[model samples]
Target: MFVRTVYATGDPAELGTAIRALNSEGRDLLEERPGYRGAGVFVDRNLGKLLTVSWWESEQARHNSDEVMRERRTALLAPFAGTLAVENYEVAVFHVLPRPTAHGGLHLIRLEFEPADADQLADAFHATVVPRLEALPGLARAALFLDRERGHGLAGTLFTDHHSLAASRAAQAAARQAGAAKVQMAVVGLEEFEVVHADAHAG
Candidate 1:
């Protein structure tokens, strides 16, 4: 799998308008493109930063869709260019492990963190969280990303249903209780979204 993540920083006062435009463009791309999968958008609590993450079946699909996406983004930001700063990245590490059957609707979890602890937080999720979640029923896939140079991060997990999501949450809570690592973790933010549609490019 290939993942593309975009990080943008803007005036806190304009975040709402920026997010709406971004999400609208996201929905349009996912609906109109053949190789598009799903995506998640997260806003830092500080309200000054936003991260948008999307998955593609392969690098080629991502490259193929870039022109359309570029146009959409340009149109969306025309009015707010000076107030917002945007950066895009082609992810180097993308891993998704299978999970068992789940019950309920599909759920996506979008997580964000502060700069200092991003790596350690990511490690804990990879070493502890991913393994535990993969064992639960209804968990479908999990992906992790880090913008090392940008000092930002994003992680997502897809559940077969709500039940699996609940179960996975419980497991995460338990892991936290065990006092794993003190990576200065903070829920810098979160966003909940549905998989409106998806298309995987053939390898």
Candidate 2:
């Protein structure tokens, strides 16, 4: 599987409007394309940041939609977005305890390292990090996305609610450090968001 992620900065108050646009118009646009699986939108009100992720069955399908996405993004997201960055990744690991829901808490850990270390990082994520995360309360899903060429990756965990998300922070921090050391990757950043919407049509 493959994924495209969009990171944007905008007014916190306008996030709701953006989410609606994404879930309706954006979703409809992507669904019309071949190999489209599903997508979600998350927001960090404190930072006025939003992350949108869409899944595809193959890299070719993902690349094919880039031009259309640029146009749709201009219409749906440009007004609110002060800054926007788009990235593509290979899905290294994906495990769902349950389907995600609105108001779910999302935590993302970003990593950076040499492209040569990509496989090692993926292995460590699957063998070590995922198990620890699965044991946490209210874990709805976890996924790791890696861009080998860019030597960038991010792991995201969605919890059922705020309390469960908060409760797992300490454990997640420890796991993050340990996993990074095991894979010799740098833990570049960590961020949190509220899942405004989520859906998965393909496993």
Q: For every model shown, what is its TM-score relative to the native structure?
A: 0.52, 0.95
lDDT of each: 0.55, 0.87
Estimate, for each residue in 76-127, the C-alpha lDDT of model 2 and write its tens digit.
Answer: 8846788899999999999888645679899998989899989999999888
Off by over 4 Å in 2: none
Per-residue error for 59 in candidate 2, Å, reads 0.5
By lDDT, the best candidate is 2
> What tens digits encode model 1's per-residue C-alpha lDDT throughout 85-128?
44344343344544432223333333445656666766777676
Q: Which predicted model would earn the best TM-score?
A: 2
